[model samples]
Target: MTTPQQPYQAPSAEAFLMGGGGAPTAKFPAFGTTVSGRVTERPTVEQQRDIKTGDKKFWSDGNPMMQLVVTVQTDQRDTSIEDDDGRRRLFVKGQIQKVIADAVRAVGAPGLEVGGILSVTYTHDGTPSGPGMSPPKQYTAQYTAAATAMLHASDPAAASPQYAAAPPQQYAPPAPAQQQYAPAPQQYAAPPAPAPAPVAQQHNPAVAALQAQQQAQAAAAPPPF
Candidate 1:
């Protein structure tokens, strides 16, 4: 028989960001560039609600809604100049979303949710340089420092050899059953007779003998007391 699935409460971004019993740190790949400073903007909350009870649609693996906005410095190369310095500088921005499993594992919120934002610069159509001059220039690019900082946060187990292998199967050994014997024709045995009790009473020999005789007579009779 298939086991019924239970309703899952997605953990909050804070919980995931702040691992249980510890502080939360980003686990994604790093962003931003080597040339300029990388900064983290304060985190913000986005409220979500469930539209249906026991909704399987949202229960399946899904990405968190949280993402980050990253800003990075980029420069458009100036064909007019000779070296790399000749490039004209410009700022670029983009958004990065959260992974589902990681989000669900986060702390505060329950259900699939994401936290964080995308860094500034991203790839899009345009010459490496500023406003069009026809020969579209290209520039060397790198992730911003903020974006790069989380490079290893998401994958804590990647370095382990066991992470790549298949999980082990769990099977319990069977238990032994009770045995039964064939019934035989019945025969009953009589219980043993009760043992006699000793009497300690007389001061005179004559009285003692008489009392002993009386007690013996009482014991010989059928048990009525």
Candidate 2:
């Protein structure tokens, strides 16, 4: 018996940062420009086309030319693009695509995903090979893995604005107030003196009379001597 395959479930639209509406497309108009943001959607491949002619473009080898589309939530703003909702849809093609792909691979990520960070910078214009051909735009890219980005985001201490503005001040709990506990001097207590023993009294009358008679005989014998 063959095991049944699980049904495919589509990701939520919010994952693409499309909860409100479609994100505005980003454009790079100058060299040395950069755009960085958290990726809100996985990169997708799409057919490349000419914006003016609305026709499909092909590579020199006659293969269908394609582009990578990535959606991100960024704070960077571009005057050329009207939408300033901070969400941008990046269309990566030609040299830029390779740069981004290489960056992702270098970090050992299979591909870009939501929660990952992507930064792309247009470094300079490349020299054109043929006459009258426009120079290609060169780009540099950087990527942070989703897990690493999430760790920074989820940590309260790391995500604090104060922490980013400056290195977190080392928190040394004030050395617990030293308590100088001096033992109080014990009072000197002398043990109470024992009570005096009681003296015994003579109670026998006969014994008392014999003692008196002996005393009388001794007195008389002394006088005769």
Candidate maximizing lDDT:
2
Across residues 11-128, which tens digit of lDDT does each residue of candidate 1 receive?
5454467445212222212332322222233333332223366332222345323232222222334444444332111222111233222322343334221222222222233344
Model 2, 1-225: lDDT tens digits are 232333354544664454543578776789887889999866666667788997767767567677877988889766765657688888888788899999999999888988999999989999997999999989999999999999988987778866544558887777778889999877755433434333332456666666667666655553221
**Model 1, runs deviating above 4 Å:** 1-132, 135-155, 159-168, 172-225
Q: Candidate 2: which stretches are off by over 4 Å?
A: 1-21, 60-62, 77-83, 163-225
Clashes of each: 47, 0
Q: Which candidate number has the best TM-score?
A: 2
| Residue range with the least summed lDDT across 10 consecutive positions in model 1 | 86-95
TM-score per candidate, chains pooled? 0.17, 0.60
Which TM-score value belongs to model 2?
0.60
